[model samples]
Target chain A: MNQKTNISQIAVVGTGVIGAGWIARCLAHGIQVIATDPAPDAEANLRKSLQQAWPSLEKTGISPGTSPEDLIFETDMAKAVEKADLIQENVPEVLELKHQVLGAISQACRKDAIIASSTSGITPSVLQQGCHCPERLLVAHPFNPVYLLPLVELVAGEKTEPAVLTRAESFYKEIGMKPLIVRREVEGHVADRLMEALWREALHIVNEDIATTEEIDAAIIYGAGLRWAQMGPFLTFHMAGGEAGMRHMLKQFGPALKLPWTKLEAPELTEDLKEKVINGCETHAGNKSVTALAAKRDEFLVEVLQLAEKYWPEPQSIMKK
Target chain B: MNQKTNISQIAVVGTGVIGAGWIARCLAHGIQVIATDPAPDAEANLRKSLQQAWPSLEKTGISPGTSPEDLIFETDMAKAVEKADLIQENVPEVLELKHQVLGAISQACRKDAIIASSTSGITPSVLQQGCHCPERLLVAHPFNPVYLLPLVELVAGEKTEPAVLTRAESFYKEIGMKPLIVRREVEGHVADRLMEALWREALHIVNEDIATTEEIDAAIIYGAGLRWAQMGPFLTFHMAGGEAGMRHMLKQFGPALKLPWTKLEAPELTEDLKEKVINGCETHAGNKSVTALAAKRDEFLVEVLQLAEKYWPEPQSIMKK
Candidate 1:
């Protein structure tokens, strides 16, 4: 087994959006990656994704190399897990599939290797139940376009070992992520649950015709969102009070606390509502092809990340400022 | 009466945060302003505020000049409104005070002059009822530090003239603002109402102990907020669907729409809640003197505005890009 101090190699199982993004980010950070998927064209698709990500990463000075040919692709899951320091599973969200894949990988990998799932909503303990090496399994969920956005929620299962957790955290940092350890496993982790709340309200507003899809969007992008990017809501409110701070604002505005909110529960996935949502999104996005939109998004993401990086530099460089 | 195409002389009543910010923004755009307040040290405070805003405007090449010497300050309301093409009132939120000031300013200013309120919640119609030339009275509500943030909500009362509305829009555009016309009268207009929804939820979360103020903030700033600054929530979701568009997203996640939200109504100004809010805010913003915190906020605001300005240039310059 490779010692803890040696440069780590990561195994990426599944070659979908999240999986491909993981491969791209890890390779860009000079970590060797062993990527595996069952689809006949998985290797080609992964290559295509990396080719698309190159320009934006280059613009932001995060391109790890000239090519991703250094990345190894394998068809066999067991082979992919062999000799890997960490395994990041990004397969379908189905619990059954997760159990089978994780069980196989855990049985095949080095005993000390840390295993993580990129499942957004599911609990780690539930997912790890079938794994023989459950102590090594946890959730290391990352947002879309992982190469650009710098946040990962490191969630530990009940059986996850402390050392494995530490190793996973260190490895995430090595690949340029700001890993936040979620103390308890909750549905949707931290960010997604908060997002779900706002998203539910947004849907309700659309359904109720209080605002159109576009108008609701306009309210956010042009308003509080600008402040939100730099500071959290609390800090924004704290600032809103001028010198008075959050408490002052809460006290002053507290009287209106019982106002009705549009925080609707998750609407039933009725065919009609789904149709409205999908159509609304299509109309709003206009003529851009999926590839075009993704590329544009990646480019903008690079710019935003670069801007954020200036304010929040690497931990080492933070002290220098 | 000056009927020329330009508005040269303007009056800013009330030298508070919003009022001073309006003065700074107006003067920076080369419109001469006559500022008035009843406080004994109003002139000194205005000067101090202007001095604080100078460095930022200077950096952006839109500096309004070094001193408020160009900004004439007067104790007498009529003297300040005399010969002014426009009057922007930013007094306290009390209705009686607003009525008194609007009545006095209308009696003093040119018949063609537009009277605009910076009130966040009060309707323009309510505020304009006391004025003789109600057609000229409207709301030109702006966020704090009006010079740096681009959004300005313009609401016309029932009696507001179309000509006045047109002129107000043009005036706001000329001063580097993204002026949004509120087609209908609403209590908090558009932006504030949406903000109040989220703010109300935030208060509930803090009061409920689901999350700390800091953690709730972290969830936003680090996650959804970054996307919001560039695009609104709907557009971001549209992009998330990877070309399937908003329709795909709404369809996929249309269920779970009725989750209970912590959307509390505005809390009553109960002494206990009031003290909690006050103490919570002070604790969150410990030790940073109000002036020092304000200065820091101003510095960051300048940077963010500059960055956003690059993406959204004056409409004319956008063609060049």
Candidate 2:
């Protein structure tokens, strides 16, 4: 499906970093954007975020032009969704807020318009529960610095239409994203849940003084992490077996299966733990502002994307049996 | 310390892929190398690997112009280690063979010369148990394509000398590696254990027909694996928390902590499993020979190393408390 007939006008609700990012990305790819957020300064904030996003996008040779002045920033949600082919909701994580936004967008947008939520952990079913037309609602979770990172987890809720998912996938591909359809609906989808497990354990290690945040980081980036970037855990281990392969590796090291893992039973969010975490992050983060750190992250993400694109060009077509 | 005063010669006692890799890295940084292997054509093989390694090294500007002519390959272990400052043993992973080679190298090399094993999983203490001078022997495990990847796990044996560890660390730094002194000796040191866990699980998935090898690889590389290249498990999670940090992440999803991981207990190396593994690798590997695959791996590794050097330059001095 080509972009002209399939995806043209896109509505981005809630002009936060993610919302503004969607607008920037869509506009960069020549898709017209209509954005909405409740706050009085939301339009101004989105304008600023878009301005900052433009140069980086330009560096990748995909400019959204001199100014996003052609983009519409509507205060009314209905007006924002009126002429949109796709609605990307970036509202807050609260169930009540999501229900309200999705319902409003569904009522105003075209019957076939794909409505995708940018929720990281909330399941599609829960978010679609309050939608007037739940069939169009699905989770399309993108990583931070959305314009750069290629992954977008497309999850279908119980009520999501199959056609909605196919159209959403096509839209993502057009905008330069690698979308993986999660077969089942689980909390946190696929990527976030696995990440949550490692993260939870990492926190426990930090709390227990087994390792500092920096040390824990060093353990991955400088060690197994370098290999992980190029190949996943399994292929890496497959090679680790020398010529013997995975079975050999497993058989040799199988006895250590019962070693205690650091996967902590989720701790109660005590006030002390909160302060400890904040302080820990602040110490390593130094005086750099959040915007600055984000910009730095985006810069690195761009480099990594360029490298991957150069090495692994996508297969032209999938051969079906 | 500058290179002049701390000038050292190294004996690379194996002339295989790893041994030649060590030679390339050491000599590129201006250290003299004495390589040895019992294979009649070991010198020829070493020359071939070096020729393959040069272009990438040159691109990184780390190749010290010394030719293969500068390297001395001998069949005699005594001649190889006679006056060496450091002896890196990359021999086959047989205990009896290691014992024999290490004993000879220990007897011939200078008393102060640190003898380091390139064993990925074998603990140094066990390897050094039969050595006459066990105090000088330790494990200096480098990842595959050692010349490119910066990480080198330096694990000390029970009888390993503290001074020897210090000297090895300094030497590793001089040759441009991020040497981490693993505090406790564990099988596979640190990285291998984590790799083994993931690998064992992957084999189980493939063995059970849950996922194909390529699918599992795509799951990681397209998802969590990409983030890992730049940040570790903890830092990446810390960022995942948005403004709430790790505590919020843990508190939200800690209840699922007890869910059984798919990480299989190492499988039995049955004849069938071995055959399956061999055939699986062969089919997936396609037409490339082992040497060809190794060469491809080396090329990618060199590119990654150059990129890493450009982005994350090793700090001259770490802050000390």
lDDT of each: 0.66, 0.64
Q: Please give the lDDT score at residue B222 for candidate 1.
A: 49
DockQ of 2: 0.12
- Pairs clashing in candidate 2? none
- Give model 2 RMSD, 1 decimal: 16.0
| DockQ per model, Cα | 0.14, 0.12
- Where model 1 places Cα greater than 4 Å from the true spot, the runs are A1-7, A39-41, A62-66, A94-104, A125-133, A204-212, A215-218, A256-321, B1-5, B63-67, B94-108, B125-134, B200-211, B256-321
Lowest summed lDDT across 10 adjacent residues in model 1 chain A is found at A312-321
Report chain A TM-scores, every model. 0.79, 0.78
lDDT of 2 by residue, B148-215 (tens): 66678888999999988988887887887777777777666655544544544444444443444544
Query: On residues A45-130, what C-alpha lDDT tens digit does candidate 1 reach at each position?
Result: 89987876655455445543436777899998999999898889998777899999999998999988888999887889998797
